[model samples]
Target: MNRENVLVIGGAAGIGKQIVLDFAGRGKKVAVADINKKALDQLINESGRPNDIFSFEVDVSNWESVQNMMTKVKETLNSIDIFVYSAGITKQVSFLNIDWASWKKTIAVNLHGLFFSTKAVLPLMKNKNGGSIIIIGSGSAITGSGGGIHYAASKGGAFGFMRSLVGELGKEGININVIAPRVIESDMLDRLYPSEGSKNTLKKEIPIGRLGKPSDISNLTNFLSNEESAYIHGQIIIADGGRTFRPKSG
Candidate 1:
């Protein structure tokens, strides 16, 4: 029996939710931590494999909350073989309109929270001496588009942070990588391109001629954590369906 334990931060909705479902479907012991209690409860109840999935409440921006959640997760999961950082917040505001509160909050969730969560989980993953750390990054970090100045800056910091972390952590048999996705069908996307016309226009801009789905990310998440991707580390894989850096399609 394969008892690989997986922990997904901000796993109640969007891409994180799909990742949780994907792992649970494979019979992995999957745990979801999110700030939304209602969504967490609902997801657990709706998930057919209740025994395979567990939920934890966490405020990624709050260090104490993150610490408490990780402690509970360690006790329940016993080990964390794969840690996916998918907790992020974004807004499509103009640069000049960006206020201190908004910038701080965005950086807190997208970067500082990453710092806290990664610190909390590193010990557990190191104990196993072999694991994968997947950061749910954004193309905004590269293209300087989508969300706003704050969002792009935060993600850019996260990308650089993990790339540096890979140098040391990889030596310990853990691989840290970033998956920067764009134009995905997410709440953030809905907010950024609310109207049908806007969405259609953005889709046409993509060479794939469509918006990306959560599964596109979740599927790659699956592969990245597998043994086949062991050699892949410290890389930022962009999955935007040719919206930005177009990959050679099959």
Candidate 2:
């Protein structure tokens, strides 16, 4: 069996890191791209520096950087069988306080990054005749928050973008989908909820009564990236531990 090649953007930590680890454990050749060189190095080290796992530093908000990173991925892996766009940024600033620069940066990393990364990998997948592209979105896109307007907008755009791409790429044997996870126990979550008690308090509102884990997202991603999920495309799978379904009064 030929080993599958995977490219994961924003793969240095959190859900992205889990996805990379999962793929590597499955004997797949994995290339991780991220803006944080230190995080990338830590990921490589934590993974025991496997020969099948490679890392690259990239700023997904920049098209030229994305192109350069993709070129490196192609050179290292030869071809990409799975592409995962997990690069994103968010701030807790209120809508009224959002500056033009902050808004643009959020959109650039969350929305434009998705577009750039996907565009960069399409040809490689098309050439292979079949591939999977999974975008890591946020449940906040569906249920908007007052402080994260820019984040919500960017993620909402991701949904629309992937849905539109379905018509364009599905026929070419390339599958695209978005996975939106909420309140996952990651560094991002830590930033959002500084106090440990605050994290626990938020969990009470969730139907599952626990914060989502990186494995929760990574397991679903693994399934979606394989042949088993061939029939699933242009869909948004929300992995929020039933948080979205809970009633306000519950």
Query: How accurate locally is residue 201 in candidate 2, as Cα lDDT from 0 to 100?
Result: 87
TM-score, prediction 1: 0.96
Q: 204, model 2: CA deviation in Å?
A: 0.7
lDDT by residue for model 2 (37-132), tens = 999998999998569789999999999999999998889988898999999888888888999999999999999998899889887787786889
Using Cα atoms with residue i matched to residue i, what is each candidate's TM-score against the true structure?
0.96, 0.96
Model 1's alpha-carbon lDDT is 0.91
The number of clashing residue pairs in each candidate reads 0, 0
Which residue segments of model 2 deviate by more than 4 Å? 1-3, 248-250
Q: After superposition, how far is residue 60 of candidate 2 from its true place, in Å?
A: 0.9
